[model samples]
Target: MLGKILRIIGIILMGLASALMILGGIGTVCIAWFPENWESLAMMAPYKLIFQTAVIFTILAGILGFWATIKLARRKPNGWNMAVIALLLSLATAGTKMYFSNMARGSVAPTNMRFYFSLFVLLYFLALRIPAIWDKIRFEGDQPDEGVGGLAGGAAAIVAGGLTLTVHLWAGPSHTVNGINYVAYLQTELLAAGVGLIIVGLIPLALDLWKTAVSRHTSETLKIPVIDNRA
Candidate 1:
């Protein structure tokens, strides 16, 4: 019963995030590229590239997230894993924008908020993925999970972690404001988180490898000829 409720909540969150990303992307493109007042936008020309790139990533994440969530709601295979990757990328992409916003204002509060929000989202998603909760949400008639085979989940984690790492690389550890190198404290926080996620991502790979090895051993054992002594 509790699992069912959590599943619904997760779906709601995904839908909300998806809608926000889509609307945000459209608004960004229109405001940054096709502005009503050309002169005002021109004044911000230096940031046009950044805005465009951010919007692209936002839209991509929104689309993937929407698809993944929909699949999960339908009890499709790999949906959970895909959603994990999508959510991570979406969080990282959104965080990058927030970081820049905080930088422009010369305040670190927004970035910190973004990081905290990210941690909450990640924790919530993971809670739902716990085996006990995950199994409870499934109906008896639903297709059996062929298991993740570890590869899909592992790959998703790697992609998500890699994106997080990339964001850290692009943002760097500090931003120069008023000729002072102001270290964005969240930069280090994100870097450490990214590394940890990468390590976590390896679990799927290891699981898959172990499963494969066990399967092969079983197959080889079965292939051995039976002794004729019983006959």
Candidate 2:
């Protein structure tokens, strides 16, 4: 019963994360190409509030998802490490974002902040892939087909991560482009790609949640013991 509830909660949290990703993605894309329009958007406190809220929610969902995965994998001696790494990476990304935001101010080049943000975003995607790799390696014998879903999900994450990395590379250290600082432009691009990848990544997560719930239901009905009962 507890497992079922946790799975349900995970599903809900994943959905919320997906929604936040979408909002963050849209905001990033809009601001990337039309930074001037940001002032207008910012004027709408609700809109800005929503974007900020999405960031916070994504961080929370990431933490919850990581925790749930670790709990589910407790029986598996080897998987806990991957879950822990993912959790740490997610937290790091969120923490770095907060740090950058705190340091950023008007018309100032956020060189260090942008670099760290990009690096952390890359790590976030990489960390997310750890579980998929572990699942593939650990469950291939018992569940020959089980790893396929995670592999696909991992591939998607890689693509998203690659996009973010590209944005980061294009956004080099403070430089000049058309009288506008390149760092500023890079910041916008990186922000857009980061949010976009996060949004895209959420789709697979939602699917994973749905699949998890279905699997849980099926397993419950079968009444098969998953582990040794010996004390």
Candidate 3:
């Protein structure tokens, strides 16, 4: 019962995060492109990159968290992994944004929305780590082979990282004043995450391959007939 409740809460938090991200993204875009008086909003331009980065980070992590929790409810092993990653990403991105917001604005009050969201994040991570909760969602039945999937995922991540890096390069150097290229730095961080994803995806494949090789070698060794010819 507790697990179920936790799952429901997690799903709700992720959905709320997604909605917040969408709204934030829309606002950011409008602020970036639609301001009629550029001079009036010139002060806002410097922080545009931060908003954009937040938009991407929030949207991606929120959506991923939503899907991952759903998968967890359905008892898929990969779901836990994805959920963990999503939460971590959310921590890094949303958490950072929240921290800055707290600094720029005022410290979040215990009754504030940020406080609730932070609580939700903490609770969700804790729920996910509970072995009892995991056992409740444990997938039964024949497991699908992950070798192909891992390889595919790895390849996709590598290709995506390469493409993202290329686009960042082609887009030209990020706007810089006073030695800060916030957008560029965020993009580079994203590129690094992509590379990390590639590595993550590859690990399962490597393990699978190693296991297959070892099994084959053992089977071959076992197949060797004991030469009773010495008799």
Write model 1 residue lDDT over 169-228, tens digit each, in one string: 433333333444333434575567557757866886787688889999999988968688
Worst 10 contiguous positions by lDDT, candidate 1: 168-177
- Candidate 3: list runs displaced more than 4 Å: 31-42, 98-119, 137-231
Better of 1 and 2 by TM-score: 1
The residue-by-residue lDDT of candidate 2 on 95-114, one tens digit each, is: 54344434442322322333
> Each candidate's TM vs. the true structure?
0.51, 0.28, 0.44
**Candidate 3 lDDT over residue span 1-231, tens digit each:** 554455545544543443333323332343344333344335455456675676576567657865664454344567656766765665565555555545543432211333345356656656666786755423222444334334434443444345334533432232332555334645755567557645754675688789899999999988967668776
TM-score of candidate 3 on Cα atoms, chains taken together: 0.44
Q: Which candidate has the top score in TM-score?
A: 1
Number of clashes recorded per candidate = 0, 0, 0
Sort by lDDT, best first.
1, 3, 2
- Model 2 is weakest, by summed lDDT over 10 consecutive residues, at 105-114
lDDT of each: 0.57, 0.42, 0.50
Q: Show where candidate 2 strays beyond 4 Å.
A: 1-144, 149-152, 155-171, 174-180, 186-189, 222-231
Q: lDDT of model 3 at residue 104?
A: 46
Candidate 3 lDDT (Cα, whole model)? 0.50
Indicate which candidate wins on lDDT. Answer: 1
- Cα lDDT over the full model 2: 0.42
Instruction: Enumerate residue pairs that collide in model 1.
Output: none
